[model samples]
Target: MKRIFILGAIFTLALNWSCGNKKTTEPPVVKPPVVSKPPEAFAGFLTVLTNDASRKIEIYDPTIENWNAAEAKKWSWAPTTALGFVTADINTFGGGTDFKLRKVPVWNNAEYAALTDNGFAAIIEYPSGKRKWSKRLSGNLHSAELLPNGNIAIAASDGGWVRLYASSQGPDQEYYAEYPLISAHAVLWDPKTNVLWVTGQHAITKAHIITALAVGGTDAVPELTEIDSWRTTIPSAWGHEVSAYYGNDNLLWVTSNGGEYVYNKTTKTFSPAPTAGLTFVKGIANQPSGQIVLTRPDYNKNPRPAMNCGLNDWSTSTVDFYSANGQLDGSRVVNGACFYKVKLLNSSYQ
Candidate 1:
């Protein structure tokens, strides 16, 4: 009887301990609160004035949201358009004379020489304030890319041709070779194949063509004659121009007054895309990370609420960005007192 009572007590105590352990181990069935992730890092744009002495090329550091303009003053000149950067002339006003000097040299027979006019190229650097190795070309250079050999390949307007150049050569040197191009505005070099991939013009009047140049010999001609050419029947009478980009899935993303068009390179044609809130699309830039930046006039016209209107209203001069798939990302209004061109720095900020 005593053994039976002891065994019963032990079993009851073990059951009680097991029940207590289960209760403590199992957490309450409460749900966790939801959290929404912040949006992606937005691209940035700035209004640049040709006359504004303070205007400069800025480098933005995303980590600290800080902008460093140390390289601005060192630049010989900068392009005036929003189509990225272009080579420009560097001129020194009132040559080599201090304003406080006794023999002050006044403006005389000094002429503005073509510091570096190898066609439409951008000044990448001007280390010693001299035009050395200032890229030279045969055709009208619309865009340039610096190569690993300290040379540059410029996309010329003459045909889909790209001219190569070395920094040690002069403007009169014959380092340029003709590569097939058709109305291309921007040319990017592919180091992998030593070839060039060009971005053609946007407008119908301008040829809608993109070409790829194969790399090999210095005297070698363009390997691929033509990659693709697209034509649209959309009426382009109102000074409407077309801009295109090679987007994801081998799709060509084009923009015009008629709206956005996506052209499948495989099918060799174009189809309209959704551009509901977009307007006055002048320039389009497709980033490698599937984001796009476009320049357009501000749509907030006069008599609209939330916008202060005045004679000095410069809101029309602005640029906005959208996602790679065509979503309204964000926008920034240029802060110049006067209306002018706006350009995006090659950096991202909040």
Candidate 2:
């Protein structure tokens, strides 16, 4: 007919150009699926353990309140030379600021460790934060604890030393079994019973570790055995400085300057927290949000200080944050900043 209609219109234009150049494997480029950024439950950096402040162990940021010093540089202390403060996830360090508060300087890490009232101890060695070991004991060595097995427990508020190191100690060493408490000053570590609760100056000891520490050579010298001990009914003249906590029913709160009480270790009884009116206490903690935190001694509060837990006027208070039924939610007025104790370290990983 017209060359068979021009060969059927060139076979329908070569069958529509071979189905548009036939590369039909086009359903395999589906990529809008990459969403990993969610690990921060709690831990926003708050471990400013000072005691006789020259800035001993600091890394603060209670959500920052514009405490002006260039905004306190995101949260002070990328510096060290401590003589106090420890506790909060085995003594917290690292991750204080991407905001110029910088990071990594917990003595340069090795799962880093810290203690300094001049008697030193900075164990380390995790994903290689390196110092893997060190100890100098004898100076004021105020506090430390990390022994659910990976040994290292010191407390030397001036030679009442209750030492025990064996995470393979050997760098600047001096800890390999040393516990016979005569007067410790707070060194608590009882994750329910890997025991060790020293606090003497009237007495309170309950150690336990008859040999258990060694995961890499040089394994010996780990023996602390003081099943249980207690004596502080306080008022031994009030120059007291205490700290004790393992609460929630079996209770056992103990803090002093004679205030902060509650000890019912199954009724060996002495209770008083119907809402303590804070006058002076030195350090007691417990808060996975159930709150009950203390650290008192408010910078001569006649006027030039701050912290007023609603001031029923207990002399102006230093650090209180109650509410395990005892009300009072917040307060922090460290005017003489030697704030000696705090470790709210579940910082949501900042």
lDDT of each: 0.33, 0.39
Q: Residue 195 of candidate 1: its Cα lDDT?
A: 46
Give me the displacement of residue 185 in model 1, in angstroms: 1.6
Model 2: per-residue lDDT, tens digit, 48-153? 4443433334444444433223443232332222323234312333221011011123333124443333345554432232444444445355556554344566
Q: After superposition, how far is residue 278 of candidate 1 from its true place, in Å?
A: 5.0
TM-score versus the correct structure, for each prediction: 0.46, 0.28
Q: What lDDT is reached at residue 339 by model 1?
A: 21
- After superposition, the stretches of candidate 2 with alpha carbons farther than 4 Å from their true spots are 1-163, 166-171, 178-223, 229-261, 264-267, 270-325, 329-350
RMSD of each: 24.3, 25.9
Q: How does model 1 fare in lDDT?
A: 0.33
Taking all chains together, the TM-score of candidate 2 against the true structure is: 0.28
Worst 10 residues of 1 by lDDT: 95-104
Best by TM-score: 1
Instruction: Give the clash total for candidate 1.
Output: 13
